[model samples]
Target: MSDATKLLAEKRTEFGKGAARKIRRAGNIPAVMYGHGTAPVHISLPGHDTFQALKHTNALLTIVIDGDEQLALAKDVQRDPIKPVIEHVDLVVVRKGEKVTVDVSVHLEGEAAPETLVTLDHNTLQLEALATNIPDNVVVSVEGLQAGTQILAGAVQLPEGSTLVTDPEALVVNVTQAISEEALEAELAEAEAEAGIEHEVAGEEAGEAAAGEAAAEGEPAEGASESSES
Candidate 1:
């Protein structure tokens, strides 16, 4: 884990949407901290500082409330759908040596073999590590990997003192034969046929066909041109 960022919080005495809105308008966000069999503490965090600190889900935070400090992790954050606003946050307390399960991102480093598509079967791996020593991400190399190659969770190396919480048999990365556009379309068509799906002509193609039919109908009858010339 990266160094914990300190955020000052104030104990909250008011509740409900109105109070929460009032808190936001005052440049703060409401949050609750609970863990280790302790009663939940409701407080408000500084808006800007908390936002910056909680950029990553696995961030470690040092919450200071009324001259007391507690280590925590943001378990959940609620944000407004249409606005850049954080409505609420749920924080879980942690001790220095406490182990916590967190999902760490899997980063691919190299290219797979030619004519192969590399797929990330699982983007993140679940790991149990000390609260203050969690890794930001796990890197896996696919250099020169050929089609049909798969990397399982058990095969991945973990940071020292970290334990894998994910199932060992979980597929992490897979390499498969790449499909060409023509092959992809053909496969889609075959699947659609098997499903009894009928596709209508595209708008542009339908318009062109209609225009050609109209022109054919407007053509003069056989020998009409000859009769007129005579």
Candidate 2:
């Protein structure tokens, strides 16, 4: 968790897409803070500073508005789909020691046993932790796990004071035998067959089978004619 970063904010009066565009043009992100049964506050935050501070998940921020500071957590951040800019932010007022549920990322470390493929069933786990003590991520060690090994959510060790909100029986990782290229292709072929998809090889084979089936009927084969012409 990163230390709270302070940012000076300005209250936004004008509302609409046009106003939001103007705010972004001035290098500020339009944001709304709501929580604790209080009225929502519409404000504008410094674009660069806000983006930097929000790099951490569940980022804690000290939002200073009109010389008054409020503690907030970056609950949701909207961004341009194609750009690296934050379009808007949703802040939830949080007090110290308050518990909040969030989805924390799962990071895998160490390698599994040889000739085994490690599949991460869950990339993140739902966790309930203190607002000010939210962990950045949960780490899982695969180490020397062998094939057919499975790791469940309950088996994962979470950070201190963090409670897992995800179902304990949920599968987190599965280790399986590594497949050869030929085996993978065969599996794909079987799946495509089930889906009624045909391979180009089947069509090509019917069209070019020895290119000479007509010869048995006393007619020049297409391949023979083409070869002769060539």
Models 1 onward score TM values of 0.82, 0.81
Query: How many residue pairs of model 1 clash at the backbone?
Result: 2
Clashing pairs in 2: none
Write the residue-wise lDDT of candidate 2 on 1-230 in tens digits: 76678999999999999999999999999999999999999999999999899888878899999889899998889989999999999999998878999999999999999889999999999999988888999999999999999999999999999999999999999999999999999999999999999755685676566555775676665545444545
List where candidate 2 sits over 4 angstroms from the true fold: 185-230
Q: Please list the C-alpha lDDT of all candidates, in the order they appear.
A: 0.92, 0.91
lDDT of 1 by residue, 1-230 (tens): 67999999999999999999999999999999999999999999999999888788699999999899999999999998998888899999999989999999999999899899999999999999999998989899999999999999999988888899999999999999999899999999999999999989997777777767766998544323433555
User: Distance (Å) between predicted and true CA of 73, model 2?
Assistant: 1.1
TM-score of 1: 0.82
Pairs with steric clashes in candidate 1 = 1-133, 1-134
RMSD of 2: 4.4
Pick by lDDT: which candidate is best? 1
